[model samples]
Structure formats: C-alpha cells, structure tokens
Target chain A: MGTRAAGQVGRSGPVAWMALPALVFFLVFGVVPLFGVLVLSFTQWDGIGAINPAGLSNWRSVLSDPGLPHALWVTFEIMILSWLVQTPLSLLLGVFLAGRQRYRAFLAVLYFVPLLLSSAAIAITYKALLDPNFGLGAGLNIGFLTQDWLGKDNLALGVVIFVVSWQFIPFHSLIYQGGVRQIPTTMYEAASIDGAGRLRQFFSITVPQLKYTIITSSTLMVVGSLTFFDLIFVLTAGGPGDATRVLALDMYKRGFQANLMGPASVIAVLLVLIGLALALILRRLGGSTTASQQEGA
Target chain B: MAVATSAQATSRREAPGTSYGRKLLRLNWLGGTAGWLWLVIVIVPIYWIVITSFKDQSAFFAQNPFALPAEPTLANYQLVIESDFPRYFLNSVIITAGTIIPAVAIAFMAAYAIIRGAGSKFLAGVNGLFLMGLAIPLQATIIPVYLLIIKMHLYDSLLAIILPSIAFSIPLSVLVLTNFIRDVPKELFESMRVDGATEWGMLRSLALPLTRPALVTVSIYNGLGVWNGFLLPLILTQSPDKRPLPLALWTFQGQYSVNVPAVLASVVLTTLPIVVLYAIGRRQLLSGLTAGFSR
Candidate 1:
C-alpha cells in the first residue's frame, strides 16, 4: 500500500513521531511495569520500605507455600465453571437476539444492566442479598434460599461463580450476537431448503460457524477471570478458610494487606504466564484442522 | 453476465419481505425459555436494589426483602449524601475525564499514524507492540505501578490513578481506532494529498470525521472502565478525599455494614450517572461495542 503512494507522491507518508507519545506512555507504564513485576519479585520491599535483595527466597517461600496451589486451583475452578455456565447460554441468547425483533432488542437493553455496574458494586449488592439470616431468603421464610451462601466452602465458591457469570454473560452474549449477525443469511436459506429442522440447522450450521466466536468469548472469559479481584475481594475476602482466594486476590492480600511485596510479585508473574498460556491455547483451538475443514465445507 | 444475474437473483430471494426473513425468525422454544429465564435472573436483583434503596433502615428489616416499602423514606439517600459522597463523585468525574481525553487523543494520533504510514517499519513495530499489550493482564503490574506512582510523588492523588489508566487504555483504543481508520478509502487520502493537505490536516478533516463513531466507542469504553476502576484507587490512594466511587462504595459498605438501605442507596447513587449515559448512548454504545469486538 505504501509503495503505491511512494511511487506516485514522491515523498514518505505520515511522520513516525505522531505515534511516539502513545508508544512512550505504554512503554513506561505498561511494558516497563511488566518487567518491573519480575524484578520486584526477586527483591525485598515492604511496599513502602527500603528495597533490599531477597534473591530466590521469595520464590522458595511462595513455591513451598500450600496456599499457592490452593489459590491456583480456586482460580482454575472459577474460570472453568464460569466458562461452562456462560458459553451455551450466551450462544443461544446471541442467536435469539440476532433475529430483528423489537422485543429481543428491548430484552438486550435490560440484559446489559449488569455490565454497567462495577464489580465492587455487584459484589456488595450480592453480599447484602445473600445474608443468611436477614437476607431475601430469610425474610421470605424460604428454607432453601436461607442457606449460608457465602459462609460455607462449597457454597461460597458456588456463589462466586454464579455472581461472576451473572455479571459477565451479557457482555459475552453481545459478542456472540455480533458473531451471529455476521453469518450469511444465504447459508440458513440453503439449509432450510434442504429440509433441515431448526435444531439440526442450529447444530450443523450455527454451532460450527461460531467456532472462532466461541474461542474469542472463551478466551476473554478465561483470561479475564484471572483478574476477578475486586469482586471476590469485596464478596469473600478469601474467607470461609481461603476457599475463594484466586491468584489476583492472593497477590492483593499478600502485597497490600500483608505488605509482602516480594512474594506478591511472584504470584503476579504466575498470573501473567497462566493468562498468556490459556489465551494461546484458545487461539490454537480456534485455528485447528476441524475449523479449517468446516471453512472448506 | 451469468454471475451478475445469479448474484442479483440471490439478493432478490433473500431481501426483506421474503420468506427468508420469516424463516430465520422461526420460534425456538429453548432459546425463548432461556432468554426469558435469564431475563428474570438479570432483572430481579436490579429491581430489588432500586426498591430497597427507598426503605428506611428499620423498615428494611421489618418488610419482606422483595416487597415494596410501606413507608418509603429518603433517609438512606440522605445519609449517603451527607457522608462525602459528592466529593467521591467529583473525583470519579475528574479521573474519568482526565484519563480519557489524553488517552483517546494520543491513541487516535497513533492509530492515524499506524494506518496512514502503513509500510513504515517503526510504525508497524509499534502497532505490534500495542497488539501484544492487549494479551497482557496489565493489572498484574499494579505493584510496580504503585512504586512508579510513589516515586513520582503521585501516590495518594487522582493523578496516580489517571496516568497508568491512560497507558492501559491505549492498547485497546489504538487497536479499535486503527481498525476503523483502515477502512477509510485510500483514494480519499490520495485526493486530500493532491489538494496539498498535510498529514495533520488530513487527520483532522478526513480520518477524524470518518472515525468519530470509533472515537466515541473508545472513549465511552475506556471512560466506563476508569469510572468503575477499583484496584487502582484501592492501591494508589489512601485519603478519603481521593476515593473513587467503587472504593468509596466498598468503605461505605463496611461502615454501614448493618445499614443495608444506606449501602444500597449509595450503590444506586454511584450507578445513576452510568445508567443515564447508557440510556443516551444505547444505540451507539451497543452497536459500536459489537462491531469493535467482532471485527
């Protein structure tokens, strides 16, 4: 593209300095801190105190700590459970919304309300609503609704997953909705003419065609779940015996709350690695041979 | 001629008012059930939040949790307002605007440069860096960001939050804006160049207007993010005067732990600005978000 311009216009195009401000800002704050997190992991700083070299001590302590594995498992559990709960519902809702119905549009507006609220606000709202004794269930005298939703281990984890899904499903569905609309109507017409029922067409056409979108949404869900700090911090504070302590929350607790910046940086590094790995895995899933075969078909 | 005719036939067959539109709208009981069922799940909590905000503290404990407040009062809202709510709201407004204006301006410039200077190795490398920046969960770098802010004498100030936010907002803003700018016809830029327009001139006149929707999308998206941001404020600032709405909401919840009505009222108060923004920009925000991600 630039060759065409250079040949005709007899000069170079836009100056590179136009991009310098943004590049410098990102490098200083984004790229530098990324490496800084790594560097800080090897040093001892009490978040506000004089820095001192700790070498591999931080790594040894964090690695040997059983809490590290438990936090990893908790993070993985929430990521997987939220993905499982959100994907199918988002796909179906996205397809239903692709139809140009006024009511569906209205429904979408209401559906997106959750996306507007801060995770802090949402967590707080649920905290009040889930109080076992004075909460909605207890007030209504409903036996099942009055359980200690955030007081027990399994139930606390379940409540976190449910709240996370409730907060995010609308956004993913919007992505899937956009994906659904982009699918050509001609394909659906052809399938209808072949006498395929709606369900068969959905399975054969809709699901297969949404392969990339599924990957995109899932990647966002999985990677984004790693940073579910504010919500869990407010909701559980990693309580009920540290049942809901994910890595990001773990980092916060270790660094800010406990003033263990060195060990916290180690956890932060692990989070970055895991997020990158999961994203790459999902991208590979999206670009697999089966997807290519479907495209060819 | 045959290819053109077949294309026309396909277009006619699939045009609106045809069976094609009706066929696609064929009822799916499962989707409908799921949609309506999910609507209930989404709406109930919100409904409860609004109605519960109106009840007085005593009435809250006495009434059914989901019932209408028999003696609704403004005391909750009153209590929330008298407790530094206005200062937090102002801080949020400043931080959001402060982060967004500079972030979007620089991002637009970068996006313009990257698109217009399409073959420049430096610009391409810069673009690639921004793209990779997308994959990084920048939140993980908060410890260092805190250090950077402290060393810069910025800790415990609104600027502490604003600077890093502008940096974080750049990657997505640049990506989305470049995608939009890349769609501008090259012939348009060429014609502008023929008229002796400089790159700056072309950016202001051609790319800027053409990409206004993208700019709005980026600004609103990043704005909402900075508005609702908790981790930065929680980590960076310690003063009560520096608290943003999310962190303010957190502390307020703690202080008023048993005063459910007051806490709920604060939640409603903090969220009202965004809900109003949503009501106004519903179409642009929704459509822009869909296009931005799916593209």
Candidate 2:
C-alpha cells in the first residue's frame, strides 16, 4: 500500500506539469492582466505615460459622470428589448421546427445563416441597403423610404436592436429546440389521451419543460448585451451624437481613443462585475428551475 | 396563414377526429408558413447583396435594389482582387489558424489536466479562474492589452491579435472541453493505469481519440469566431496591408463609395470562406454552441 501510494504521488507530479504551460499562459494573459488593469484603475496613465497616483479620482469621476449612467441605461435597454423579442419568437420557432413537418431541417439551416456570417458582413450589407444616396431608396424610387437609418439618433438604437435580434434569435431558438426535443413522447401521448388540444398541450407542456432553457438563454442574452461592441461599432460607431454608445464602447473610447487608462479600467471592472453578477444570478435561477422542469412533464 | 393541403385534410378525415383536430392541423400549417415567411425575410438581404455584387455601377443605380442584375459583370470581382483583398485574406487566414491551433491545443491539454486532477483543490480553483474569464469582456482588457503589446513590441503585428485571441479563447475552450472530459469514463483511466501508461500517454491515446468529436466541434466554432473577429484586429493592427477582411471591408466602403458593386463584391468574397465552412460543418458548429449549456 505504501509503495502504491508513493507511485500515485510520483504520477501526480507529471499530471501537474501538463497544466504548467497553460497555467503560465493564463497567468501572463488572463489572471495577471486582470489584476494589472484593476491596479491601473487607481492610477493615472495614458498608454506610455509615467504612472501617477490617483486616490479614487477615476472611480469618483466615472461614478458621477452622466455618460456612465446613460451608457448603462442604453445597454440595459438593448438587453430588455432583445429578451422581449428573442425569447418568445425563438420559442415559437423552436416548437414549429420540432413539429412533424417536412421542411423542418431546411428551415433550421436557413434560420442559422445570419449567425454563420460575420457581424461586419451583416452590418455593411445593411448600411448599403439603408444608404440614402444609392441604397434601397434610390433603387425603389420612394422618397419617403430614404431616411438615414443609422444617422438618426432616435432610430439608430432601434435599428441596431433589430439587426442584433435577427442574428441571435436562431441561437436562442436552438436552445429552446434542444429543450423541446428532450420532452418525452410518452408525456405527449398521455396528454393526447386526456384530450389536450395543441395550444393547451403547448402551454401546459412545452413552456414549462423549457424553464431552464429560457433561464439559460436569458442569462446569455443579458450578459451578451452588456458587451455589445461588434455589431453596434460596425453599424453606427456609437454614432450620430453617441446614440448607440454602449458601456463597452465607452470603455474603448476612454481607453484607446482618449488615452485615459485609469477611468477606462474602472469601466472594465464594472463590465466584469456586472456580467459575472448577472450570469451567476441567472445560473442559480436556471439551476433551481431544473428540478421543477424535471418534475413538470 | 396557409390553407391546409389535401394531404392534411385527408389525414384529418382518415383519423376521424373532432373539430379540434382540424384546428390543430390548421395551426401547424399556419405556424409552418409563418416560419417560412420569416426565413424569406431573412434571406432577402443576402439575395440583394449577391445580386448587387454582380451589377455594374450605372446598372446598379438604374435597377431596382431587390431586382436581378440587368447585365452581370465580373469587373467588380476583378477590381476587388486588384485592390489587395488577397493580402488581407492571407492575414486573416494566418491569424485564425495561428490563434485556433495554439488555443485549442493548450486548452485541450489543460482540460485534460483539470479533469484528471479533479480531486485537487488547486485544479478546481484554476477552473474557477477560467470561468471568471468569460466575464472579463474584451473591451475591458483591450486597454491594458494594448499597453502590454506595445511594451513587448508586438503592437501593429498579427501576433498582437493572435496572443490575446488565444488567451480569451482558452477559457471557453477549457470550460467546454472540461465538461466533455469529465463525462469520459474513469474506468478507462484505471485500465490504462493498470497497463502503466503515463498520464500524457493516456491523454494522447485515450483523451484525444475519445474527444475527437468535441475537438472538431471546438475547432470549427473557434475558427468561425476568430475569422469573423473585428475588434482585436481593428484596435491592435495599423497598416492597411496588415488589416484583416473586416477592416478591409471598412476601408473598402470608403474607397469604393461610388463603385458600390466592388464593395459588395468584396463583401461576398470575404464571406465566401465562412459560407463554405458553414456548409461543411453546420451541424458541428451548431451542436457545439449548445454543447456548453446541454452539458
């Protein structure tokens, strides 16, 4: 036994070594930089400047700044709009595709096309389509249809939300579809014997069975909205008087554009905290609902 | 809404069901038709993009935006080729390949170690740190990363994007594959141990082979993300020659503002590679997406 225990100890050392390279890599890029930025949040420095000490000044300013609150509000607004649009639409589509239909497979592939293409590609395509000079308007010869979609502050955020929803609905739909597929056929048959109509069967069966899926998708959508950079950046560049400037974009503007590392780091820390907090909360919600979903059907 | 087909009508009668049966059947047809219509709305923009790419400048202005091209021309394609899109293509290919290979390899080995060392508190803590990675949005890290890269003199180089992309990617890769590895039967490890195989050898023989599907799934998924990645390249690199396709497309929109066909043509070219990958690995890419939550 002593010899076997010694042998296990010897083997464990090599097992630890396998993780060393990755551990070192993460330390350099992941953990170390994470803390480095946190420390940088407390100091005043541009990219190449000497680090000058600041006592809660960066945080103090960011907290009182109007941009922070407005950016936060817009970010949550996008999150709410996305959740409202994507969740139900995806649920309906998921159920429709999972039904015994002929074109289910083809439709699944088709719906997923937006996700396959890059956000850059999608944004540019839309930009051309919405261009007043030579876009859909000039081609269609309808003067009223020629409004500058991305240029108008009021319309740009909504347009961005619409485009983003188009790309992500399929993703959320797939989650709901996975959940729908897991519902046992026997349960449906049991409902059929009791004469539950399709709508009744759907409401009582499909929705409740998808509790965890809904929670998971909602978590992803919320966290994802907080980091809305690529599509909005490509579409509007936080455009037409900062209409679509999300917190993530604000972080970029402060850090890279303005060369204010201290305050930018503060935003970075907030993004990390907000994202992790929401995900953890929603994950717990998802976990608790799993039992109810399991007991549902 | 759609009228029920004769097939459904016949089936409903053959089943001898109540009126509720007819309603359900009608609902299915209605729902399915709505799904088809929504899909058509989604595909219309793609159709417009492809058709617009083939039109000449004057013909594009003359024609209806959604209409078919009057006389399709390859000149736009030629123009894009001559304008150095190929260089950007090469750069993107290099970055994607560079980032995915190392990220996946490092992540796979780390995942293996984590799974094997599950009893160790240190490994669990490491796993927690990786989860924390998903929370650190790239925008948050780009500032420090910019400074760090410049200090290392990797700024304005593809290595800048490659290194951070690899770093950000590892957390997800490790999290995903760790879940898969945890599901691998422990009895296999014990059997290999009985034969005196080292952990590395076991990883090579057992883990690599057993996790082939997950590995492939991971590769295509990460490859897509890296290929379509815009921010890192935009912030990190500077030279027009060093720019990737997304940045190339951005600059293309400006230079070819008058020649819209050339710009759309470039868009098509940039997206073509992704389309091909999607065609081949649609299932793998998609199932990989849901794999995280399902696990």
Task: Return the top candidate by lDDT.
Answer: 1
DockQ, in order, for the candidates?
A: 0.43, 0.36
Candidate 1 Cα misplacement greater than 4 A, ranges: A2-14, A288-297, B1-27
For candidate 1, write residues B1-295 as lDDT tens digits. 6466456545656454445445545547678888999999999999899999999878788888888999889999999999999999999999999999999999999999988877778898999899777777889999999999999999999999999999999998998898889889989988888788888999999999999998998998899889999999999999999999999999999999999989999999999999999999888888988888875
Clashing pairs in 1: none
Tens-digit lDDT track of model 1 for A75-142: 99999999999998899999888879999999999999998999999999999999997788988899
How would you encode candidate 2's per-residue C-alpha lDDT over A1-297 as one tens digit per residue?
A: 322444676555666677776677777777777777888899998877788989799999999999999888878888898789888888888887776565786788888888877888888888888888888877898987688888898788888888988888887777777778878888777666555567767888888877777876787688888867878887888987888888898888888789898999999888878887887777676666454332121
Report the C-alpha displacement of residue B189, candidate 2, in angstroms. Answer: 2.5
What local lDDT score does residue A94 receive in model 2, on the 0 to 100 scale?
A: 80
TM-score of chain B of each: 0.91, 0.90
